[model samples]
Target: MSVVITQVFNGFSLGSILLFVAIGLAVTFGLMGVINMAHGELIMVGAYMTYVVQQIFAKYAPQSMGYYFFIAIPVAFFVSALLGWGLEKILIRHLYHRPLDSLLATWGVSLILQQIARTIFGAPNVAVLPPEWLDGGVRIAGVVFPYKRLFILVFVILSIFALYIYLTKTPAGRRIRAVTLNRDMASCLGISTRKVDAYAFAIGSGFAGLAGCALTLLGPIGPTIGTYYIVDAFMVVILGGVGKLIGTVLGAFGIGLVSTLMEYSTSATMAKVMMFALIIAFLQWKPSGLVSVKTRSLD
Candidate 1:
């Protein structure tokens, strides 16, 4: 029973982590319908950004090593956002209506990013050490929950709030969503569709960056680490329903819990195969997913 309780808790944490990654993918795909195969590389870039900050702090400001994470959050977001923006301007913009072309281009971009990382950071796994404040665990009723996971869970909540505010309340977000819902109408109403695209892409990339920062708290990271979860992230977004925030959240947690629990009784490979089989079966009934998002075309 204790083990069951522990696994459940772990499942929630894992799901939340997956949510951080999936939310970004959901937003980008929802807004542009671009299959961003390079999205995982953005996560890897954010993780590497955190690692860079750690190394910098360790060298010049060892006394403030504990504060490295606080600093890395914004830095990673900014750097990753820039990269995302650049991708949109240089590559993605050309393939807006060509979904297959976008997929291939981004897949190639992903390969390029992986090679770049290997060239700079090598083929080994790298990790970031947690802050002193995040070094402990809390045990309650015989269930031990790590502080880092708790911190990540809290981060997820805060991120959701921030994202909600951004997408629903902010002008820039509104412009992006407006463009996404009806590009012709939005442009007719004086919104710069191109700029909005750049902003949406940047914001989506920022979420992936933030996810990578949270991942550093969990375990060792490698260039391929993001790829390991990209498929799952896509699964969550697809299952949740594109562009439905609440649906994505529920879907991420559901898949996270089920996958974690299944891996316990079965092999990791089998758990993945079974989960995917389940998703395929489920999708056969509801091709639109758990929630249906309506755009101008759908409407």
Candidate 2:
């Protein structure tokens, strides 16, 4: 029973990581209908930013090293979001409605980002030491839960809550939703659809970046770190239903827990293969996804 509980907790922690990474991608894809191939690179960028900040503090402000991770979170978000904003203004904005072009362009951007990272940071993996606060675990009923994972779970929850508040209560969020539901109608109602696109893209990019920063607590950082998880993010989003936060939350945990349980009985590789097969079968029965956004159908 203790082992089962531990495994379940681990699954939730893993799901939290996926939730962080997928939220941005889900929102951007759902709202803009753009397959941003460069999103994983943005996650890499965020992890690198966290690495850079840690190094900066270690060299110049050693006394504050313990708290630098907190500061790095916002910094990573801003940097990644700024890059996303610029990409939209310069590249993505023009490719609206041209899904193929957007895919090609962003895939190229991802490669460029990977190369840039290699040139600047070298090709080897880098490690960021977790702060003292994240070094321990809490024990309950003979099961020990790591602090780092707990922090990530709480962060994911807070992020979801904040996003829910923004989307349901705020004017800017309403504009985003309007555009998500119907770009033409939103524009007709005086909402600047283009501006909303930019905002949504940036927010999504920022969330991925934030996820990357949190990830440094789990393992080493590398140029292609984000690429490693992009597929999983896509799977979570596709299964969760585009543009639905509740679906995303439930889907992530469901997949996370199920995958973890499967791993207990089979090889990791087989577990993923089985998971994909299940998803394929599930989608065959319901092509729309677990929960779809209600919008006006185009005739």
Candidate 3:
């Protein structure tokens, strides 16, 4: 029973990581309908930013290094958000209705970003040391739960709650949803669809950065770190349902739990293969995904 409980907790922790990575992606791909191949690069950028922040603290304020993570989070978000805003204004804005072109352009951007990271940070992986407070685990009922993992779970919950509040309570968020539901109608009603797109893209990119920051607690990060998780992020969004927050949450936990259990029972490679096969079969039955988003169509 203790082992089972531990495994379940581990599954939730894994699910939290996936949810963290995919939440931003859901906003970008689901709401905007753009296949942003460069989204992972943005995550890389965030991780780099966190490293940079850590270095700054280590060099200038070693005494306060333990609290550097709190500062790094916002810094990563803004840096990535700024880059996303610029990308939207300069390139993505022109390719709004053109998915293929957007994909190609973003793919090129991802390559460029990866190369830039290599040039700046070298090709080797870099490690970010966790704070002293998060160095150990707590034991409950003979089961150990790591503090880092617990932090991630809590962070994901707070992020989702904040997002829910923003989307449901704020005027800017309402504008974003309105544009998403019916771009033409939103525009007709005097909402600046283009501006909403930019805002939404930046917000999504910012969330990706937050995920990157959280990742530092897990392992060493490299220029290609984002590439490792991008596909999984996309899978979560697709399996959940485009433009559906609740679905994204459910899909992330569902995959995480199933994948962890499969890995425990079998091999990692087989687990992945089995998971993919299951997803394929599930999609065949429900093409729209777990929760379908209903949008207003002019046609």
- Candidate 2 lDDT over 70-155, as tens digits, reads 98899989999998998899899999889999999999999999999999999999999988888889999999998999999999
Instruction: List runs of model 3 lying over 4 Å from the truth.
Output: 294-299
lDDT of 1 by residue, 139-224 (tens): 99988899999999999889877988999999987898889888999999999888999989999988889888888998888989
Comparison by lDDT, 1 against 2, better one: 1
**Better by lDDT, candidate 3 or 1:** 3
TM-score of 1: 0.96
lDDT of each: 0.89, 0.88, 0.92
**Candidate 2 residue spans exceeding 4 A from truth:** 294-299
- Model 2 scores a C-alpha lDDT of 0.88
Residue 22 shift from truth in candidate 2, angstroms: 0.1
Return the lDDT, model 3, position 92. 93
Which residue pairs in candidate 3 have backbone atoms (N, alpha carbon, C) closer than 3 angstroms, thus clashing? Answer: none
Total clashing pairs for each candidate: 0, 0, 0
Clashes of 3: 0
Q: List, residue by residue over 167-226, the lDDT tens digit for candidate 3.
A: 889999999999988899999999999899999999999999999999999999999998
Worst 10 residues of 2 by lDDT: 24-33
Q: All candidates' TM-scores?
A: 0.96, 0.96, 0.97
| Top TM-score hit | 3
Candidate 3: worst-modelled 10 consecutive residues by lDDT: 289-298
